[model samples]
Target: MLNKTLVPQSVARKIQGMIQTGEFQSGDKIPSQREFSQQLGVSRASLREALLTLETLGLLETETGRGTFVVGGKPSSSSHMASWRYSDSYSAFDVFQTRIMLEGRITSLAAGRLAASQLDQMENLTQQMEECWARQDLLSNVEADLEFHAIIASSCSNAMLRSLYQMVREQISETQRHPIPITEPARMRASIAEHRRIIAALRAHDGLLAQREMENHILNTARCAGLAP
Candidate 1:
C-alpha cells in the first residue's frame, strides 16, 4: 500500500513502477479511479493527479469512452510534450530560446562564485536525476533537474541576472519538465554527462567553458522536445 502521506508525485512513481515491471503491460486498461484509490490507499483526488501525471509522461493514455491504457512501445515524439501551460503568454520555443540565453550567462557568472557546498549539492541532485529516471520516477527526476539548475542560478554573481531568472522561474520549470515524455533514455544519459561537464568547468573556474556547456545542455534538451533543430 502507498503511504497515506505520499503526494501525487510519489503515487505517480508507484504507478509508473507497476508499468515498468509489466504488472500493467502495454495497452492494458487500468482500474477505475475508485478502484485505484482504494487499492493504493490514497484519496481519489490524489489518484486523479497521479493518473494525469502518468498520462503527461506518456506512460498512459485515456480514451473518451474507454478506460486508461498503458502506452504501447515508444511514445510518439510528435505529441509527447505536455501541453504548454504558458501558451497564453509565450510559446515553448520562446521559453527555450530565452533559457539558453539567460542560463548560459548565469552559469558563466556562477563559475567562480559557487561555494563547495553548492557544488556538492548540484552533484548530488544530478545523481538523483539519474536514479529517479532509472526507476521511471519522471516527476522526481525533473524536480532534481530543476534544483540542479536553481543552484547555479542562485550562485551566480550577477544579482540582476539572478532576479531575472527567479522572475521567470515558472516558465523555466515548465521547460525543464516539457521534454521528459519524449526523451529517449540515451538523451537523458547525455544530459547527465552534460551536467558533469558543466560542473567540471565551474570547478576549474572557466566561465567561458561553463557557459558553452550550459548553452549546449539547453539546446540538447530543446531538441528532445522537438523545439529546436
Candidate 2:
C-alpha cells in the first residue's frame, strides 16, 4: 500500500522498486488503475501519471486491452543493448501484441482526420525509407519509419491515444536502434508495399479499411520479428 500523500513520482519510484526487488515479476499483470488508486489512497490521475511515466521509462508496459505489466528488466550498460534491454524481459512479441491493438485503433481514428499535408508527410517518409533501404542505411530507414507512425498518431484527435503512441513509439525506437535481421532488403521492400496500402486506405477515408491495413502491417512486422504466429 502507498501513502495517501505520496506523489506520483514517488509512487513511480516505489513501483520501480517493487520490480527491482522481485515483488512484481516480468509479465505479471498488476492491479488495475482504479484498484491501485484505492490501495494507495491516491487520486486516479496521480496514479495514471505515475504509470505513464514508468511506461515511458520502459520499466512497465500497458497493453491496450490488458492491464499494465512489469517489463522485466532494467537498462543495460552496453551502448548497443541499453535501448532495448526492456525487450529481454517482456519480449518483442509483447510490444507487437500491444502495438497491433493501439495502432489499429489509432489508424481508424486518423483515417478521416488526416490533413492533406499530413498525407504528404507520410508519403515523404515512405520515400525516405525507400532511399534508406536502397543505400542499406538502417538508421535513416528507422528514422523515417518512426516519423511515418508519429504522423498518423498526430492526425488522431484523441490526446490520450497520442500520448500512448508517443510512449510506444519510444519503445519501438529502442527496438529499431539496432538493425533487425528479419528486416532485410526484401522485407523492407514488403514493408513499403504495406505502407502504400495503409496510405491508400487513409486517402479513401475508410476507417475500417485503414484499421485493417494498419493491423496487417503491424502483424506482418511482428511475424518478421518472430513475435507472432
Candidate 3:
C-alpha cells in the first residue's frame, strides 16, 4: 500500500513505474477504480486524480464504456491533452496568448530584482525538470516547470502586474500543463534550453532579452500543443 499522505502526482509516478517496468503492459486494461484503490490503499478520489494525471501525460487512455488502458509504446502525437476545464470562461489558445504577453512582461520586470535564493531555486527547478522528464516522471516535470515560472512572476518589481498574474494563475497553470501530453522529446529538450536562456538574461539584468526569451518559450510551448503557428 502507498503512503497515506502521498499526493496524486506521487501516485501517478508509481503507476507510471508499473507501466514502464512491464507490470502493466502496453494496452492492458487497468483495474477498475474501486479495486485499484483498495489494492493501493489509496482513497478512490486520490486514485482517480492519479489516473487522470497519467492520462494527461499520454501514459494512459480512457474510453467511454471501456476501462483505462496503458499506452505501451511511444505516445502518439494525436493523444489528446486534458480538456480545458476553463472552456466556458476562456479557450486554451486565449490563455496561451495571454501568457506570452503577461508573463513576458512580468519576467522583464523581474530582471535584476530577484533574490539570489530565488534565482538559485529557479536553476534547481530547471535541472529537476530535465531529470524528471528523463525518468518519464511527467507530473513532476510540469510541477517543477510551474514553480520555475512562479518564481519569476513573484519576483516581478511591478506589484500591479504581479497581482494581476496571481488573479489568473489558475488559467496560466492550465496552459503550462496543457502541452505536456503532446510535447515531443526534442521539444522538451528545447524547452530546457529556453529556460537556460531566460535565466542567463535575468542574471545579466537584461530585461528585454529576458522578455524575449520568455515570450519565445511560451510561444514554443503553444506550438507544441498545436495552438500556435
Candidate 4:
C-alpha cells in the first residue's frame, strides 16, 4: 500500500455513493462511459477506471454484449463494511468458519517459518495492541491487530498460503472495530493474554499448539467483536 496510490479510489467512491443513496437503483442501467464522463466532469479514462472498480465490487455488472447495470449497492451506515461481503454484510458464523479453515493452515506453516525479526515484529505489534487497549481505542487496536496478522501471514513458507492469509486479514481487520465485547476492559485484557499465549506457542516452534492457539484466538476475537453466535 505504501508503494501504491489511492488516486483512482474517488471514482469508486462516487459510484458506491450513488448506489447506496438510491441514485442508481439495482438493475438500473448506468450512463454510458462518454455520457457519465460528461455528467461527472471526469475524463473518459477516469470513468472507465471507476466502472471497472465497481465491477470488481459486484455493484455494477458489465456485459460484453449488453450495457452496464447495477447489480447491487453498498450496505447501509448501520452495517460494517466486511472485506469479504459482496455489498451485503457477511454472516458471522460463515465468516468465522472460513477463518478457522484458512487461518488454521497459516499458523501451521508460520510456527516453523517465523524468523527472528518476524518474532520481534509480532512482539512489537502485541505491545501496540496493549497500548491501544489501555487507551480504550477499538480502531487503534484493529490496525495493530492487522499488522500482527499480516506479519504472521508474510512469514508462512508458501507464497499462495501467504496470499490467502493476506486476503483473510482484510476481512478480519474490517470486522475488528466496535464489536460488542470491545466495550469491556475484561474482554480486551483477555484478548491480550490470548495473543501472548499464541505468540509463546509460535516461539516454542510447536506447530500443533500454535495452530490451536491461533484458531482459538480468532474465534475469541470474533466473539468479542460481536462476530459470533
Q: lDDT tens string, model 4, 81-132?
A: 2233422656656667777767767887888788878888788888888886
lDDT for model 3: 0.85
Per-residue lDDT of 1-229 in model 3, one digit per residue for the tens?
2443266667787898898789998879999999999988888888997887677667888888998998853434336776676899999889889999999999999999988888888999999999988876677788899899999999899999999998999788778777777878889899999999999999999999999999999999998888882
How close to the true structure is residue 122 of candidate 4, measured as C-alpha lDDT? 81
TM-score of each candidate? 0.77, 0.61, 0.86, 0.60
Reference-based lDDT, residue 40, model 1 = 92
137 Cα displacement, candidate 4 (Å): 3.6
lDDT of 1 by residue, 41-157 (tens): 988988897787677667777888998888843433325655676899999899999999999999999989999888888899999999987866676788889889999999899
Q: What's the distance in Å from true for residue 168, model 4? A: 3.8
Candidate 1: residue 199 lDDT (0-100): 95
Superior by lDDT: candidate 1 or candidate 4: 1
**C-alpha lDDT (0 to 100) for residue 143 of candidate 4:** 61
Lowest summed lDDT over 10 consecutive residues: which window, candidate 4?
Answer: 74-83
**Predictions in order: lDDT:** 0.85, 0.72, 0.85, 0.67
Q: Candidate order by lDDT, highest to lowest? A: 3, 1, 2, 4
What residue pairs clash in candidate 2, if any at all? Answer: none
